[model samples]
Target: MEFIDLLLLFVTLFLAIIWFKYWSVTGGGQKNLPPGPPGWPIVGNLIQVVLQRRNFMYVVRDLRTKYGPIFTMQMGQRTLIIVTSSDLIHEALVQKGPIFASRPADSPTRLLFSVGKCAINSAEYGPLWRTLRRNFVTELINPARIRQCSWIREWAMDIHLKRLEKGALETGSVEVMSNCRLTICSVLICVCFGARISEARIKEIEAVLKDVMLMTAPKLPDFLPIFTPLFRKQLKEAKELRRKQMQCLVPLVRSRRVFVQGGRCEESNIGGDMEMVSPIGAAYIDSLFGLEPAGRGRLGEEELVTLCSEVINAGTDTSATTVEWALLHLVLDQNIQQKLYEEIVNSVGKKGSITEENVESMKYLGAVVKETFRRHPPSHFVLSHAATKETELGGYTIPAHANVEFYTAWLTEDPSLWKDPGEFWPERFLEGDGVGVDVTGAKGVKMMPFGVGRRICPAMTLGTLHVYLLLAKMVQAFKWVPIKDSPPDPTETFAFTVVMKTPLRAVILPR
Candidate 1:
C-alpha cells in the first residue's frame, strides 16, 4: 500500500510537469513576464525549493546567472518576482512606491503567526499601516523618544553587565546570544508596556515568542495551500501561541491603563512597578490608544496586543541576532575587536561607561556594525512585498498581486558594488562608495539590510543604536576570548534571523 501511494505521487508530479511545459508554451499571459526556470504545474517551484535545502536567496542567486538580475519563480499558485539588482530594487520599492509597498496576502502560515494581519510588520501598506507606523515613530522610535528612553537602555545595560559578570564567575563562559536576547527583551518590554517586567514574566514572553517564530517558519504547506490540512497540528499550535501572547500581554496593557487613569490596581504577579521601569513618557501601547485608524475606529485590545508583541519580537530577535553576529565577527578577528575597543576607549576612555550618546564618536565601531550588517543581514530579504497594480520593473511586467522580493544578500555581495565582497573588511565602509552609505537607499542602494522607501524598517535607527551600544559596551566591559581550544566558527543558519549555526561560547574577563 505504501509503495502504491509513493508511485501515485510520482505519477501525479510527472503529469503536472508535462502540463506546465505545454501551458507555458501556449499561455497568453507568459508574454512580458520575467524569464525564469520553467516550473511544474500546481507545485511550481516547490520541488526546486525542497531540493535546494539552502537559503532561498542562494537559489535565486544561481537563477540570476541564467536569467539575469530580475527573474520570477512560481511557488505553488503564487508568482514570485526576485530582484537582485540594487537599481531595480530601488525602482520597484522606492520609485513605484505604493504599487510595491503592500504586503503579499496572508498565506495560511502568516495568518496564523500575525493573528490576522494586525501587526505592523505584516499589515498591508495603507492607512492603518501608516497610522500605526506614524504612532510607532512619533512615540517610540523617533530621535527624541529614543533619547527619552535612554534610562531604560541604561537600566537594561546594567542588568546585562551584572548577568554576564555572574555567568563569567560561575561558569567561566556564557552563551552570548541568550544574554543579548535578555537585554534586548528587557528594553523592548519596558518601551512597549511602560514597565519593567520581572525576569520570570520576561522569560514566559520570550518562550512564547520563540515557539511562535519556530512554528511559523516557512512550511511546505504555506506554499501549497491545498496541503494545509496536513499542517493542522501546526496551525493549531499557532492559534494557541497567539492566545498565549495575548494572555501575557493584555494584562500589562490593562495594568498600564489602571496606572494611566491614576487608579491603583493589585500588584502584578510578575512583581514590577511602572515606576521601576522609569516610565519613558508614553508607551507604544499608550500611543495606540490615542490613534484613530481610518475606517477602523480605535485600535482594540487584540490589535494592541499584537502590535506590542511586534515591539518585543521585532526589537528582541533581530537586534539580538545582529549583536551575536557582531560579537562572532569580533571574536574571529582580535585585531578588529581591539581596533573597535581602542576607538571606544579614545572616545569614552577604557574605564568610562559608554552611553548611547558615545556611540556616535566611535567611528570604527560604526563601520564594524555596518560591515556586520552587510555580512549577515538579519534576513536575506524583507517580508515579501506585493504589487498592488501591474508595473514594469527592469523592463519586465510584474502583474498585479505578484509577490516581489529583493535579495539583499546578493546585492550586498555583488562584485560590482563592493571590492572583494567575500572579505569581512570594515575598512570598505570607511572609504569610497561604501563610505556613509545610506542604508535607507535614498541615494542609491548599496546595501539594503533594512529595506527602502515607505516600507523601510521604521526600527532601523533604534535597532542600530541597540546593536552599537550592546556591542561597544561588551567590548568595553570585557575581553571576549574564545573558549580554550575552541575558536569561534562563523557559520550561517536561518531561523527567526540569520544566526551562527554553532553558537558562540566565549569567556569574558574584565578588561
Candidate 2:
C-alpha cells in the first residue's frame, strides 16, 4: 500500500511536469491574455505563494511591479486575475457588475464549510443571494433597523467600559482587541438572536468560530481540489468543527423559531430568563424563517444556523478589527489623536454624553476612521469573486470562470492617487483631495474598504457606524497609554480578518 501510494504521487507529479512543459511551449494559447510570470507548469505559482506563508498580500503587491496593475497567475488549475487599479476594478465590479458578480465554484473545502453554499457569504449570485442579502439588510443592517439596535450597542459599551476599568485596576494595562472582540460578540449575539447570553456561552461560540476561521484559511488542496483526498484529516476536522458550530448555533435558531411560533424558548431562562426580545422583524433569525427566495422554498434549520453564523461572524470580527486598528494608529500618531480628541470635545462638549448623532458632526473623527480603513483594511483582499463569463478587462481577455480579486489596501495607497500616499495622514481626507470621498466608488474609485457594486457588503452602513460610535466613546471616556516598556506595533496577522499581530496592550487613563 505504501509503495502504491508513492507510485501514485510520482505519476501525478510526472503528468503535471509534462502538461506544464507542453503548455509552456504552446504559450498556453496566449493571444490576448494578461501578462504574468511563467509560473511552474502543473502547480503553477502555488509553491512560490505557499513559501511566503502568511505574507500573501506582500507577495502579490510585489508582483504588480513586474506585471503592472492587472495580472494573472495560475494556482494549480485555477486562473487568478488580480486587479490593483481602482479604475479597472470599478469597470469590472461596477460597470460590468452582473458578468462578474457570481462567486467562484466552491472547492470541496468551501462546500463543506458553507454546507453546499447555503450561507449568504458563499452562495452563488442569483435569487438565493439576493434573497439572503435582502433579508439581512432589511432586518439587521438597514438604517432604521440599526437605529433600533442602538440600545444594544449602548448596553454593550457599558459592559466594555466596565471590563476595561476592572482590567486597568487589576493590572496596569489591558489588551484592547481581546476585550473588543468580547464586547462585539456580545452585541452581535443580542442583536442577531434577540437574546443576551453569558460570557461562558459567548466564549463557547467564539471557540467554534475560531475553529471555522482557522480551517477556512487558504490551503493548497482548496485551489487544487483533485488532491482533496489527501486532505482527509482537514476535511474530517471541518465536518466536526461545523457540527460543533451547529451545536452552538442550532439551539439558538430553534429556540428563536419556537418563540416565534408561539412556543416559549426552552433556554429563555438559561442565561437570565431572557425571553427573546427581537420581534418578528427585529431579528435576523426571525426574518429567515419567513423568507422565500424567488424559486427556492423558505430556509431550513440548517441554512438558518449557517446564515445566522455568517451574520455573527462577519459583524463581530470586521467591526472589532477596524476599531482595534483605529486605536493603534491613534496611539502611534499622537497629533492625529489630539486633533480628533479636540474635535470630539468641541462638538459634544467635555463630559457630554456621546451618541450616534454626535459622531456625525465629528468630521475629524470620521476622517480618522476612514484613514485607518485605508491604511489597514479589515481584510487585505476583498472576498474572492469569479467571472461569470469571459470578458474584456483592461484591454485583455479575462477567461470565464476565472477567480477575481482586488487588493483594497494597496489600492488605497496607490501613489498616483494620493499625495504622500505612504504617510498616515488623516488631513488628506479633511481639506485635501480625499474630501467627501465616496467609498462606494460610484463617482470614482477613491477607496473601497467595504467593496462596491452589486456584491458590496450589505452591512457597510452598520459596520461603519459601529466603528464611529465605538472609537468616539473609547476616546471620550479614557486616554489610551501604551505599555511603559512596549510600544504598539502595526504589524498585521490575518485570521478570518487582518488583526494586530500582537494584541494592542495599553493602559486606559480616565479623562
TM-score of each: 0.91, 0.93
- For 407-494, candidate 1 gives per-residue lDDT tens digits of 8888768899888888889988888557868899987888888888988989988999999999988999998888898888888887
Q: Kindly report which residue pairs in candidate 2 clash with one another.
A: none
Model 2: lDDT equals 0.80
Q: Write model 2 residue lDDT over 1-511, tens digit each, in one string.
A: 6999999999888768766664454235464678887787577888878887747788888998899989888877677888989889889888999998888877676677676788777888888888888778777876788787788899888888888989999999888888888888888887878877778888889778877877877787866776778889988888888889888877788667767787543325434434576555567777778888776687777777778777778878898898998898788877777787788899887688778788987888888888888878888788889887778999988777678878777777887888887777888888886888888888777788888888888888787887898888888888887888889988788877888888888878898
Off by over 4 Å in 1: 1-29, 263-276
- RMSD, every candidate, angstroms: 3.7, 3.1
